[model samples]
Target chain A: MTTPTTGLPPEPAGRRSWLRDHSELGVCVMLLVLGALVLTDALTMDVDLTQRGPVGPRTVPVVVGAGLLVVAVLLAVDVVRGGRGRAETGEDVDLSEPADWRTVLLLTGVFLGSAVLIEPLGFPVSGALLFWGAAFALGSRRFDRDPLIAATVSLVAHTVFDNLLGVPLPGGPLMGVL
Target chain B: MNALTSLLDGFGTALTPINLLWAAIGVLLGTAIGVLPGIGPAMAVALLLPVTYGLEPIGAFIMFAGIYYGAMFGGSTTSILLNTPGESAAVVAAMEGNPMAKSGRGAQALAAAAIGHFAGGMVGTVLLVALAPAVAGLAVDIGAPDYFAIMVLAFIAVTSVLGSSRIRGLASLLIGLTIGLVGLDRMTGQQRLTFGSLQLADGIDVVIVAVGLFAIGEALWVAAHLRRGPPEPIPVGLPWLSRGDVRRTWKSWARGPFIGFPFGAIPAGGAEIPTFLSYVTEKRLSRHQEEWGKGAIEGVAGPESAASASAAGTLVTMLTLGLPTTAVAAVMLAAFQQYGIQPGPLLFEREPDLVWGLIASLFVGMVLLLALNLPLAPVWAKLLRIPRPYLYAGILFFASIGAYAVGGEVIDLVILLIIGLIGFGMRRYGLPVLPAIVAVILGPAAEQQLRRALQISDGSVSGLVGTPFSVTVYAVIVLLLAWPLLKKAVTRRRAEH
Candidate 1:
């Protein structure tokens, strides 16, 4: 990705440089779009006018939508005015770094997979898989100990949450046996 | 005498085997979550909210209270050992604690923190028992205008105090206030920002927003910035505090609760501000100037105590006013509402047993926390050894499961992902997330009160300032807003000299 320079000078100490860039501009545009979407829905909302004394249903939305517009403008103004707040203190992580990308993708995969598999595999088995997979993603290659630890954690959590705390997590295929 | 006797009765209810067990569970969970990096007590309580659904109301309250203080203790442990604070309140602890660890005095720092925590927790609990009813009595007399004024003050205070920059904080808060307006209007049944999504018609769950922002967002942020370096091995030594160390810390422990409790009782009052204030105070008052940043024992003692004390203090307002001073308190308040037991002025008159039993259990929970944290500091430290990948993966899995378990709605999972992305972006952009979370929780309540005040006065703006109490509250808000500018001016003049 090309770094689109907005010609704004870099931030001073203790401030983030990204805020000086065009990122927030994109966010503001998104907010405006969201506001339009919300306002459209709010206009079509069925409001009862008979029971209320003063304030009605559309009052808060209209107010909120208008407020969002005002803030979006202010944020735009701040960006243009080069209003720098605090400088970023820590070393910036390289977004393009392959190692970093691997970790990100691995974690995302684990989350997505767990969401899909949790009901079928049960929390105990799926949770263990999730935990072990994540550990592997984060560079823990202790293959011998990882599975045992993951299973232990999953079983303990299942026992506490399902048995003691009474959360009705699916016991999966092992429901009757367990 | 009557008050004393009533407290004894309260204690009687609290010490019951069932209540005691719940309290123990709450503290244990609180401390465990607190110890974990990136998870605070708020997320802990929110995550556990589903589990508490079937619990007896009293047991639920007991467990919630335990988790509250337990997180405070656990947070300090991470600050001391890893320099990764679980919450903002522990940031000050990290200053001295990390230094202490580097110097091989980690045990002493941990010991001091535990003791300070115990002292602060006890003092705050005592205040809660003695002062809550009186506060509740006073609160009953307050009208919408006064409530509105107080919330305004809270909004300003929290935004200005919690973040590195006020503009970003306010922006975050505004975003929250906007989110708060999404559900059906209390006065008019009209949906404000639902956008034809039926699941959103009921409004976004505070739990979903909270869990998404704090838990899921944090997990993502950590994954992106995952450190590849080997863990710093903490040196082992005697875990006992020296007599001199104890003597030095005692004064700070005693003073910390006084500083922390009042802040905790106020709206927007959470552990962050008081703990920061406590750390600055200890630094300013210390005779050992060289020890200020070089593993000063006082640094660990004061902030830890203040954080724990504030936890206790927050419970007082939560129980009495039906106002949540922090995210964890809000979840607990929601839990109480689930049980159909409103925690406000009438609570004492209506459910004295539940109120007092909960209060007494705080004392017991504090003792248990101290016992567990003091000797088992190393055990808690070992939790940090879990690989970042596995840890975050587990968190993400649990967060999704917790979201699904809440309503069994796929929509909630979608909201979680959206909010998680938003949270990740917020962190990436350097915006503070706490104020946003706080605003989301309080925004609806604040707006409703404002609208009601306006209605009462026939849409007159002056209606908000009608009563003497309301006037006083607004006056305080004005002063609070102005005080920052005044302080800045005074400091500039001094610098010029």
Candidate 2:
């Protein structure tokens, strides 16, 4: 489960075992960075003296940033001392198993693909691709039947939104026809 | 001006032919989505917000009321038949409901759950109508200092009560506040965290955060450990139970509203704690001890009712004070905001017809839910067998559509993807997502009220505790945060003996 999911280079052997165990320190680092960024932005903010009051807009951010720094330090200490969150078992989920990365990557690509093409291809076409790609990612092996169903679903969704619901979803090349 | 008179007038609007039609459509759509795994009412409302954008505020909200109850109604079906409760509130139901289904008593379990929802929803609505106006009347006197005090209490209690740990909960809240701070400052019109991005200056929409967290985030997590093979859905028959089953359920159903209402009425309103408490209560008071683990009808009736009743209790705070204690309420708040409306105490005096109509519709929606869902239980159960991949993929498709349709900008989709990833990471690390959502919706409001109180006091910090109400609220907040830890320490020490 601790497998590097972001397609990063594998960790060096032996020296970083402790870091692997306390991988949540990565969250600590992110929080600290965020806090520092907020603090720097707030401190460097130029306030007009004429407009300034008792509590400027920077006050809450400064307090929040400081609070975040304290929390990040506390969380890091806790993680280094072997504190860890228990896996959620309340649902039917089995969290101990490694993720099916192939499927996840495929689904991610499908969403990003639809996002990139939504303007150029329109709802009917891009939506069909999204639905088909998602179906393929989810292990539907019937290439012949799945895309047809995906198109039907996409067209129906498009008609419902664009025509019936009056949301004016773009139709791309089919803009005039739709 | 009386509550009863206002409610009767509200019925005048809700019972109209067109409004009735909208209510019907809302429930049908709501139940369909709720029957799907991991899609709760909040996600349903956000995804469907665009569909109802053209309707009048009353009609839209009437539909929203229907959808709200319908989600609770459908969530129980998934729990009883699939053993995969879609909402956290229904997790308790899955315990006995799944066992009942395995024993070929699936129909009885579904009936108990549906009927229990009906009973609880009606009782909860009655309580809401009776209690809300009075509370709003009292809340009219609550100044900004008291309001700020209560918001602080809500922040502390919600984070501590719901999450796996207080540390993670606070982190989630701070992150929400940070995300909320991205837009222009409310008082001074200055950018705090936009990072010089023109698109982000308008702020990330609450609907995006909601759908991204509950719908998209859950999708990603489920995608990682994608369950292989088809889930065997329990085949449900006609919805009915034996006389003995009915007899056994009555007492638990009666006890449900009693145990559920007070816990839900409190400031930290949610279905989770009360539903669990009612489950424990029913367990302790059950006649058949052997049936506790196997399949108890009481188990289904009590928790489902508690969940629905808690939902009703949440409305007390949501409607009367404009405080949203749960994620669903927060999105509903956004809905109210979308129509250029706010739901503070003035809402009652200014929009009596709308408020009472919505309340009246809650009663109407409850009856409609039982009548509509009871017969359709078997059909709804078949939806559980939808291919996991396609079903979840369908959810993502709808999520993107909902996000993009909100503003007709591709930038919203980008925000959706970013927030969805953050949501996935939050869940992966065992942080509760609800607080972040609650904080996002409430943080700006909290800040506004805090600044108002201070401005009124001319920078005197002591003005925050100027009133008895504010002082009492702060004291309760301290107790609420400390009592659980104190109890745990005492219990641990005693156990060492």
Candidate 3:
């Protein structure tokens, strides 16, 4: 599909970086790694001597592992043949613009930070931080209003989910207050 | 008559004040969340699924019935007012309804949609009441091998029929299958992919996967490409149809469920095709043929009914066969699992009240939706104007709470983040998320069925295709997988001629 131009040199502006052009190869790589992991795990599993069925635990995993490997190879071939996966589009999505990695990374950091802090800080504090940080990450800049709203949202969620709903959430330092 | 008696009893349970309150709350919350610009019915349900976890099973399911209908109505509301479809099913709604909204006929469009929804849902539920029992009875005779074959057929259908790239879809399925394999083998105590972690032994919660993939993944995806500036929701008064509007749309509403339910009842039959079918049928049969592209009310009426009808159809498949053909149905199936209820042939016999009550509430929900939403169309439209930051932040916030609250473990949060990243990657690469979700929910069951079939045949491979039903299902699977290649060859042959 990429027929070379013999007379004129390839235009740099028209060309994308190889990684960007073949970003789907990353999915292929991930699939391959997953396939290998599944296969290794299945092959190493200990089967009891008194197994009743020929279709033991390893059978499905082996088939699924092989399927993953086969699909990874097929996807790679399709990618090399100039077939491209379509980026998902939605109402808010502007695919014409490149993905904003900064927001995604910031949100990821906030999520992980909350996960780490939830046990120590309790949901009210950590959940508020999560909501506020996520809002900030998504470009909400009102420090006063955002924190207040975040706290309200967090407290309500904590109260409803923990106090009312009976999902046990660690209260951290606020263990005795409420 | 027997079905009627069962349905009456179901109403007895669903009509209680407590259950009715849950239904009302589900409808309100489902519509509120679903009215958000980017959230679809599936995501709305997934995000709210945790809330119902603490409730008793019957009340929760009644709530689910309301949420299901409410989210769908909300999706159409968004499609009409903002021309922003939350899911593929609503794309047809946006087609004629958005144009209607643009022309200052937004109220009529909403009226047509709401009424159409009520009509379609009523017909679909009636048919479900009539047919689901018979289907479940027939399903009782299906052997393990046949069941496995059907699962295989489902996998093939979702991967091949729904997505543009079959390979990508298959890859997504494999990813889900791998995730499904994380827990200990049910028969043996051996772990398949637990990696020695205690949390992994229980396997990743379907709620975590669903919320991560649909809610968090979507939030992150939208955040990365947040449409700057607020969405201009079309201003509208109460949704009210004229006599002529009703006369024109009533037949289309009748026609839509007949078209939608059968498609939804079949394995791998989704709402998308039926919606398009209804729109085209309405166009071909309409007196106002030229008005189709120019915002004809029939276009809104037919497809909205069809989408609603298909939702009912999806429930039929889910309840009778334990097969979920759409993302929302899959999540609902997961909800059943969360309640330790396996929705299959035995479900009708095992949980009559739960099943009948859920079915009964569908009828009740339709009435409630029409009554509540028709007067509140303008209010629902206002929900579209919420700031993108706060809207998406709330999604992540609730998503965190839901995931964490599932097992109440910090590890679930970590797993949620990982799944969320994978989901982000999936959207970036254009892989369909539905197939992965369906695979995750059904993969373990499929494996168990295959093993059971094989065990019965004493390790013989022929055991997989031992039954007539299994044979037929395998044949369909072959045809489905080969369909694209066959199409390519036929086109090439035509060119040669």
Candidate 4:
């Protein structure tokens, strides 16, 4: 999908080529779909006719929905008008690198794990696990050191918040033991 | 004289061992975050907001102030070392400082930036001390319509002037406004966009949105297009700026504050414009044109100074007018509200110590920042060598911790992830983040004022435009909107020759 290089002077396009070539069409379609969904939601919203005065519950949504639709239309128009910058039309940056995926997956896992474990594991252990897991995800191969770092981060954070600051953090299963 | 005595009294309050410790901790944390690429003071403040909930109000504020200025100082470190600017204001510094680093003058660039930051920060603090009370006096006269007008002006300036395209900027801002509307309608207590979910009732925390968009979203975007390349270590040299280099940069450093402060005071626009303006002005004024874009010391000094100065200027407005000119300022305002102290004209009369002590601490912060940045340039540069995977992972970990800690709500974590996804998408599509941030912070306030104005005028549209002050404010907004097109046209006309 790469455009042939013309003899024309290169434009000051930085990262726009990604949008110009591969993503603009998809982005345009997505915008239209999002706009349509929002518009539909906004339309179906029950207008509180009972409220007196100029603005009701539906007023702001209708305005915002219409605005979104208008912007979506404008964006589609810009794509059609060939105003897509060079960054959009250029070759996509490679995403196959392990470092990138590892980071992303690690973060995703950390968030997911934090959600699952926060109640059972408690704030201190869960927070430490989350922290250490994330650090590991960022490619920290220091197996021996990771746990220490994580535990320390979680423990110190707990002490500061729970003990010193007096904010109640969950004690988890260790409620009585700790 | 009375003010000076009161300020002295504030120093007495701020200089306490507890307050001093908090300030130091805040600066240390602020510097660490600021040195990281892509993170800035706004995110730093947001991340720390939950943690600060337990501290006494004065100590919390002292630490917050330290973070604000400390982040500014730290932002310059990244801009000078790597081309990756931690804050929008430091973007200009990166343009020249990166080149300097590449040319093996990394140490000189660091020295110039640190010194420039100190000078600009000092000037901004002095201005804050002198002008805040007067500005607060004027703020007392502002009615709802006036507040509405000012917010409108801020929205227009930020969304229209920021980023490469006005359309995209406005779009980003609209998204933020929409997000801001997710919670209950404050006026009527009616559900706006909760979609029947109880978790969405209180609305998404601004911190969740910020962390998601900035920290998580940024990490995701970076990861998705990771280049498998060996990290380049920036070579370090002598930390001190030579006599000749200092002589050249001194003028730019002096000029930078004036360039930065006015822009900072102007609501909505970020530090980017002023720093860019300062760089251009320095280039035009300089005798050594050949040095520019090729590691010019003035290039490093001017923009760095302007960034810090503008940061100070933003603080003035936040404290006095309760108006946030930038994202960082907006977050700071949120922090103030969290402390149960609403900043405005009444703030001076009500909480003189908090306001003045905060102002006095800026001067103290500049000294601490300089000492840390100047002698420790190499140490800061070592931060860049941190493996990307590890760095980003650390950010995510802390982000979740911060988000969860904010209210201890499990739903906040969900909000963080969703916002992070939005942020990632925006960055992937080249949509600017700051406009959305500024809009989110100002959106509810703007809507509140607009509704109040409408209510006051008995729902007359013209009543919204009735006051002279409102008219003036709208006029300024219109002028700002039209200026870019006018400038572009003028530039094109010149090129036609």
Candidate 4, which segments miss by more than 4 Å at Cα?
A1-22, A25-52, A84-106, A174-176, B1-5, B95-105, B227-230, B235-238, B488-497
- Candidate 1 lDDT at B367 equals 91
Docking class of 3: medium
CA displacement after TM-score superposition, residue B491 of candidate 2 (Å): 2.9
lDDT of 2 by residue, B1-497 (tens): 88898999999989999888888887887787788766788878877777655568898888887888788778878888878776677788889999999999988998898888888888888899889988999889999899899888888877887765777778778888777777888888888788888888888887788778877777777777766654577898978978999899998887787667766766554787888899999999999879987999999999888888888888888888888877778888888877878898889999988898888888888888888888888789887777776777788888888888888888888788778877877777766787788888888888888888888888899989999999999999888788888999999999999
Model 3: per-residue Cα lDDT at residue B145: 95
Over 4 Å off, model 1: A1-20, A46-51, A83-102, A117-159, A174-178, B267-269, B484-497
lDDT at position B303, candidate 4: 82
Name the top DockQ candidate: 3
DockQ scores for all predicted structures: 0.31, 0.42, 0.64, 0.29
Candidates' interface RMSDs, in order? Answer: 4.9, 3.0, 2.3, 5.1
lDDT: worst 10-residue window of model 3 chain B: B263-272
Indicate which candidate wins on TM-score.
3
Candidate 3 per-residue lDDT over residues B8-75, each given as its tens digit: 99999989999888888888877877787888888888987787668899988888778888988898
Better of 1 and 4 by DockQ: 1
Task: Give me the chain B TM-score of candidate 2.
Answer: 0.96
What C-alpha lDDT, on a 0 to 100 scale, does residue B223 get in candidate 3? 86
**Residue B323: error of model 3 in Å?**
0.8
